[model samples]
Target: MVMVKFLGSLISVDEAVNKATRAFKDLVELRIIEKTVWDALYYVSAEDILALIDQPRYDRSAVDGYAVISSDTTGASPTNPAILRVKGYMSPSSTPEEYVVRNGEAVELATGAPLPLGADAVVMYEDTNRVGDEVEIYKPVPSGANVSRKGEDYRKGEVLVKKNTLLKPWHLSIIASTGINSVKVYEKLRIGVIGTGSELVEPGYKLSSGQIYNSTSVLVKNYVETLGLAKGKYYGVFPDEKEVLREALFKALRENHLVITTGGTGVSDEDVIRDIVDEYGEWVFRGVAMRPGRPTSAAIINDKPVFLLSGYPVAAWTGLEAIVSPTIYSILGLEKPVKPVVQGILARRVPNTVGYRSYIRVTTRIGPGNKVIVEPYMLKGSGILSSLVKTNGYIILYENIEGYEKGSIVDVILY
Candidate 1:
């Protein structure tokens, strides 16, 4: 068995992420996913798309009026309106007639109707009176007024959406308008999750004297799916035995691109994850200098990533947010996900250890002068899962910073 070298000092969060990114930079697999333009909502584009056809397709009217030459209605008013011969009516769907508006002629058309040949402007009916076959145009219009020129919205061969763009609703509409029926998107990542511990039991099962319900597996699966990062497959709970853990880890590694296991990462006798990593995998990092998740570890088995997170609910969650999530984003060619945050004043003094990064959970309320007041959750233990439910988000204390004083303005990342 290979002896594992545990780094004496913990690495910073940025260093850890950078290392993981380099390890998996060439591992992201790209697949062409064909989706109909109508149902392609929220799918990231795999390639840049060019317009196949122009919008409007032709010069059209923008209102229900008469199409005419601008020079014909020049200097016309109510008192001395320009009189022009009225031609046949034109609907939006009708083909443009083989006719032209002479110096003193008009063709009545509805909104969106194609402009007849030689017509450069439109005169609203409200500004003119009709008598027999002639109408009076009271207002003067310039060339191209009230006209939507062909290719005005988008020209053919113009780039509509760039590669790796997350398609929104409006993007789908635009693609459809360009006559594109389908688009290509990247495939979702496949992630395998395993929760290990002899004392762990699945939810709805009766727990024995030393057993607790297995919550981390479900949490990991749901969190991965909800973020649209990957499809999570839970392999159920495994005992702390080395052989059993090894078999499960090997199977998960073979089946998924990435694997995550919660529990058995600490330095206790039952913590068999470290030994398994030493025996069958290459250890990347054994720990990070972050509170609530100091024992988080990562390894490479058969050239695939395997993250070992703490069993405690809060610690497991922190590891996922700080480590696993960033790695996945890097693989997907996306920018790091940003958490919504609010600026607030710390309501009380909080102490922390220097050289260790801290995540302090806090609840917020509107205080005097409409200022947001953040109240830190007193219970800071990693095993206290209830604190997560009670607090909206957490405030980060950097590794070099000791703590925050009362009334200090800070940014709180919301859940």
Candidate 2:
């Protein structure tokens, strides 16, 4: 395979994502399967929304306050209190056979209890005075007070959750209220991760003169799982041998929907990953114009997408965020993966390079004027893990502009 080098261009992040997804759109398929709600939180597939219907068909109480006929306390005032006898009490879980709420009678009820047949409103327990089962109300309440009318929270057959929503605690509650125990969701994306470098050693091992710690494998694996995208298996670090690299690349591509590797993507003597992908797969864009991640590589191997991330910690992370994330989401058939976009003020003047777009690490906070103040972390080297640990987000210096002035309106992607 002849190696071809291409200088990266300054492309809009959104446009790049669109172009990349369109290039390989038909290769991945979405499979929706029915699964119990209890087993759905393990991965992205189970978190997808199928349907969001309404609550049960009944008028229920929203609070444990009280149940009353609104008309009974129409003219009741603090000076002249209205007293009534306690007719009965009702709990949420139990069904009450007797629903007779006569005038001058107040019924006790718990939170989520269905409104009695005759009660048109409810007075809170705190607002009423009960002297040995005799109830006294100082204020008058209107009809439907303290009551959740039937179909009020949600109407029957009303769709609450749209398709592709990531199920949260509230979503699960919605499903349970809608009487749905199971839902249809998309299948999770399977990811394989390979760390390339002969000198790299895994953590918990003694450091030698010729060895470095293998940080990329664990980092990439955790990164994939944190997004609820996929379960990643780390194949550990391999040497620069072409045959070993080829076997690892081929195996990962054949089994996983996506394979992401760190190290060996740089333009160095030991960088064999890009060459391996070039030999085995259809190479896509091989480089990006963004600093730190300029050496990034991408290709399709055995019909599966493969990404060769930079050996630098921050670069690998940035490239994964900018490229691999969207690809995974698209393969899973998710419409839009919501990312946190924050607007901030540049604390100081930012100098930029002429042709290369820069991603500067920044620390963001709300200042005295309630403005988001972003302070640059000032670390630009690709291998600086300490900078990433201290920074909160990234600030972009566009290719068109030379630099940014203090107090400029800048948009940032919050980490």
For all candidates in order, the CA lDDT equals: 0.85, 0.75
Candidate 2 per-residue lDDT, tens place, 1-415, comes to 5374553654554555665687667776557777676766633434424334445356677777668888888778777878888877887765645567888787888888877778888888777887888888888998888887777778765676666666666766677777778877766667889988988888999989999898867778899987774778877778988899889877877777778888887656678776777677776777777776776767777887777788778888878777778766775556546669899889998888766677888899899889899898876687888778898888878777888999898987777
For model 1, residues 1-415, the per-residue Cα lDDT tens digits are 4443345668877677777888776765757789998867766788999999887888999889999999999899999999999987888887766467787899998999999988999988788889889999999999998999998998999999988776778888899999899999876677899999999999998989989988877877888877664779998899989999889888988888889999988767687888888777887788888887887888888788888888888888888888878877876788766889999999999887898888888999999999999999998787888889999999989888999999999999999
Off by over 4 Å in 1: 1-7, 38-43, 56-153, 168-170
Per-candidate TM vs. native?
0.80, 0.90
Give residue 93's error in model 1 in angstroms: 5.4
The numbered model that scores best in TM-score is 2
Clash tally for model 1: 0
Error of 2 at 111 (Å): 1.6
The global Cα lDDT (0 to 1) of model 2 is: 0.75
Best by lDDT, which number?
Answer: 1
Q: How accurate is candidate 1 locally (lDDT)?
A: 0.85
